[model samples]
Target: MTTEPSQLKFILSSVLLITCGQFHYTFLFRAI
Candidate 1:
């Protein structure tokens, strides 16, 4: 199967969003 550029971008953006959310939660915990 061939990968589409837009589909790859969507996956990357979602992964980034999830990582950012995790990082934000960790920072908040550390600050408390």
Candidate 2:
């Protein structure tokens, strides 16, 4: 049960990282 929760957290973090990366790129493009 603990392992399942950890796995879910890892997946959620990865999705968040990707989304943040995309947003960062867009912001940079707009700044340029």
Candidate 3:
């Protein structure tokens, strides 16, 4: 049960990081 939760958290964090990276790139592009 503990392993399951940890796996889920890792997946969520990875997805969030990817999304944040894309948003940052777009924001920078528009600022230029």
What's the lDDT for candidate 3?
A: 0.95
lDDT of 3 by residue, 1-32 (tens): 35688899999999999999999999999999
Per-model lDDT: 0.99, 0.95, 0.95
The window of 10 residues in a row where model 3 has the poorest summed lDDT is 1-10
Candidate 2 residues 1-32, lDDT tens each?
A: 35688899999999999999999999999999
Measured against the true structure, the TM-scores of the candidates, in listed sequence, are 0.87, 0.86, 0.85
Q: Which stretches of model 3 miss by more than 4 angstroms? A: 1-3
- Best candidate (score: lDDT): 1
Cα error, residue 7 of model 2, in Å, equals: 0.5
Candidate 1 C-alpha lDDT tens digits along 1-32:
99999999999999999999999999999999
Candidate 1's C-alpha lDDT? 0.99
